[model samples]
Target: MKTTVRRDVLTLPVAPTGPENPLPPLRPPGDPHTPDERAKNGLPRDMARQVGYEPLRSLLPVRLLDGYGRKRTDTPLGTLVIENGRLRATVLPGYGGRVHSLLHKPTGRELLYRNPVLQPAGFALNGAWFSGGIEWNIGATGHTTLSCAPVHAARVTAPDGGEMLRLWEWERLRDLPFQVDLWLPEDSDFLHVGVRIRNPHEKPAPVYWWSNMAVPEERRVLAPADEAWRFAHPGGLRRVPVPVSDGADRTYPPRSEYSADYFFDVPDGARRWIAALDEDGHGLVQTSTDLPRGRKLFVWGTGSGGRRWQEWLTEPGTGGYAEIQSGLARTQLEHVRLDAGTEFSWLESYGPLSARADLVHGDWADACAETRARLADALPGEAVDAAYVAWLARADTEPGEVLAVGSGWGALEVLRAEYKLPGTPFDESTLGTEQAPWLELLRSGAFPEPCEVAPPGPTLVSRNWRDMLETAPARPLTEYHLGVAQWHEGDRAQAVRSWERGLERALSRWPLLRCLAVADAVEGHLERAADRYAEAFDDLCQERRDDGAAWTAATAALGREAISGLLAADRPEAARAVWDRLHETTRAEGRFRLVEAQIRYAEGDIAAVRAVFDEGFEAADLREGAEPLGDLWAAATGGEEIPARYDFRLRP
Candidate 1:
């Protein structure tokens, strides 16, 4: 009956998460809303704190992962399973350490929504997020950048002296190292996860952590709150009554008409939990320690747009799922500050709950009480607190066995800062080619320059790295990286100067030119920006032709940007020329197909636009709030009813 952790392969039809886009994410993170709005909207006290704290100016260090397409193939993902006799948890070590499946052994029922396919969607902040299971969202409000990325995994001793699976990685957005440990007690039906986020830096760090569990939407979602803060697309937060909001019982996902987030206003000292129960009053329940108090329900409702979004995330025939989430703050919009040299830790438990069906379906208060009482009987809040305390003792225990390897950014950061992080060791060996250039820059005073043609190594924008780059010898690569860091730090004028200086002596001028183009666009110079984009695209094309397919990813990325800019500048012929020069494989991608459709639409060729849609292609990078497909359909076929598959307009 002892808990054991072992590695296994989870084979699913996975769309490959293709090469990262070379372009930097220039768009600023959405505003956290004014204080007056928070006050007027009835936001709780803690929820108001740090609402706009250290918002991201740019997603530096983390590159955009828009390269994935809709085409899927049978791919074997590495997984680690933690089982005790009563319950089993399957962890995708290669995918942000997501819990791919949680099974209640005796009942032979899956507790979480186990996705049949690994389809990378653009729900993540940095793109490439798959549906289903439990995802640990960190760094920012949206899905973590690591949604489709790997995390380092190892086997460690749990509180019960049994094997536990530990997944740890350095979150680049906030420059923090975090770890998630999954285990189950002997003969226990509930799976236990202990999470820890450490701020190794001297200054305070704004941290966000939300554990999102996907479950079948055909259930009554319950949380211990009468009033909740509802956030709909293209709107600010507003207080709404739970269960029944907007003249419908929203607890039932089908009752709503659009996608929305309902963050439960759990009262002070209330047991923090959320559950989704079927008509028979039997389903999964998640309860966590006091520190992780926030509970939320995100439903893509029964409307055509919502349903279409569901189908787009997975296969067409699969059942839809809703998210039940727990977080450190009252809402995902606010980030709690983790003080210097401090770490936040919490324990979470997942198990099946069965209550009286009538009470669960009746009055909202009665249903929440029924669910809470059942959860107390199964796994009490006090017991969860005790588990957290016990976990704290072993949080520093050195890991024993390596299960999977993630990015070496943690090791590089640790090596640079001489951090004495225990349990989760970012060993020197974990460092890879991505960390090589930084390691060289750290060791020698000079930043390594590219001898041959290749995209620039990823940029580091953290203050420490930025300071180091500032002191490095002045070379083209050094200037380029420094400019990126400066741009991320909000020094636009200096960033422009650095890029212009770098371009003067640059062998590969396209990267600097692209950065300058983005800067110009941000400064409201559209035509000038388009010209820079065109120049950059031409330079990148020359490099691709000379360097062969190694530059294909960069060429494709630059080509998309250039064409979009040209189209925006009313230069359809120029955009068409850029499209014509794209590699055939790049042109065949779903994203480019949409681009082609846009180009044709801009050129006043309605037939060509309709032809592209008739062929049907999935835009893998379809943004959360954008409705490009629906817009194109409307433009091509004026007033024609949009097909169900092409409709994903979330807002009214």
Candidate 2:
């Protein structure tokens, strides 16, 4: 099957321009902030200053006349010449073949230019000239083929009856065909440009495209992705890496400051798929199908210093390229070039998702998934699975899948035990070290002799008890503890028998003697492991109180029981009451808003959940150091196909 390529057309009509005069230099935005402000507020200041850059000058002295009048310029970047109040910019040698600003003849509004290199030093205007009009062509095929060309200048007219100046000269390649046309709208807010490319090759070609523009930092680039790889340049020399750990996989490095000349690349076949985001995740530029994957994926940002000839190539600290390569560094070049006659195309549609704030979480998630899917497709199948497994293993603490019958439960208990320990306290000397400290504290009764007003609590009271146990430690006691640990490891029946024997021996010594609250909690956890929700809830609750950490502990146990009841009985309403109480208590205690959101979602209140997200977004610190709630929310709301815990599958 052959892949057919097409372009979607969009038109923008320019509004009527007021009477024009000799235009003054372009002005910057109203509230132009410094680099520090941009960094502190997460804004992109480079783009906002594009218009105010130096005007383009022409290399050769030239004069052109349209019905409006005559225009002339000398120098390189380009020159602003007007005919009958109509304005057109032509190349002037000193101006460097680049056109900085082109204003409407009547309105004075700026003309928009879109290119893959979002920011290029300059443009090459007038590469090839035919009689009566100018033809602009770009080499697309592997060979030099000018298959597509813009309509001759004679056939095109400025929107306000102004002269159209040829901005850059383009060369057509044989195998690839690319062309862009400027359409001045008679009545519109935007200057419309249409781009087209055609590839008739038989093999897949890797390409990168981007519409390089200087936009404001307040505007956010919105593309699909969980995370973005970001690199920031502080001095214009070395690029730093900042890894966004919040489920976002993009690799952008973090730096303390930013200079100009930052390059970012996207991969091929992913056209207009990535987005440029302002500090608040707002969209700045949208791409069309004409954007080259190689160019679009590879993004470059130059600072005001670079814009001026003063610091060109001066290496202003660490400003370098920030590009997303199609493949790794080694294979990128091969990926960009397509075989002859093979068809390749990139279609990107851009628009604003937000007016003030940056892209939202849903938007970010969608973007992340799209980018990840592309990356996955790029990798080999075996490699993909292996990578995924590695990722899961890194995230998991247990030896086996959390749902595995014997192994999984056992692993969980071992993990919990390890978590409870103070930190790697299981070595040969661990027991001795732990005992020595307590023994010293106990023999001296240092814990009982308090410098503070309140006496030691039951924990300190139980210090003596622990000391006695340590002093007269026996094999049976050790065996009992091991048996209890085994019970926690999911050897339930064995644990019961061992505990019974230990209980008998302990009772023989003292009728009131019992095991630790931790033992009870473990037993309770195991009972619930067999679908005994009520029993488990009761056990955990009792253990919580017995452990003298009742308030929060009981609340946690109640929350789990409520969720379990909801899952078991399928009665959302009853579960909602429990969720509400938990919400109230947690809010009162100022903790776990995400948990509250999960509970609200379980109660079928999506708005409440979203509201919680909004609140969390405002209180950015809350999201820091918090566990993920997406999985729990999915399970509790019946959206997940798998259980949250491994309890059900192991039951006989």
Expressed as tens digits, the lDDT of each residue in 298-335 for candidate 2 is: 22223222222111111233233232211111111112
Which runs in model 2 stand beyond 4 Å of their true positions? 1-177, 197-210, 216-219, 227-283, 290-354, 358-652
TM-score of each: 0.97, 0.27
The residue-by-residue lDDT of candidate 1 on 1-652, one tens digit each, is 7788988888899889888887777667443222335443555565665666776777787998888888889988788999888888999988899999999889998988888999898888888899999999999888999999999998898888888788899999999999898878889888888999999889999999999999999889999999888887765678899888768999988788888888898998888899999999999999988898789999887888998889888886899999999999888788889999999998998999999999999999899889999999998888898888888889888888898999989999989999999888999998998789899999996799876778887888988899999999888888999999999998989999999999999988899999999898888888998999999988887766453544777888889999988888899999999999998888998889999999999999999999988898877888787788887888789969888878888877
* Candidate 2 lDDT for residue 161: 38
Residue 81 displacement in candidate 1 (angstroms)? 0.5
> Which window of ten consecutive residues has the lowest lDDT sum in model 1?
31-40
What is the number of residue pairs that collide in model 2? 135
Best by TM-score: 1
Clashing residue pairs, backbone N/CA/C < 3 A, model 1: none
Quality of model 1 by C-alpha lDDT = 0.87
Error of 1 at 144 (Å): 0.5
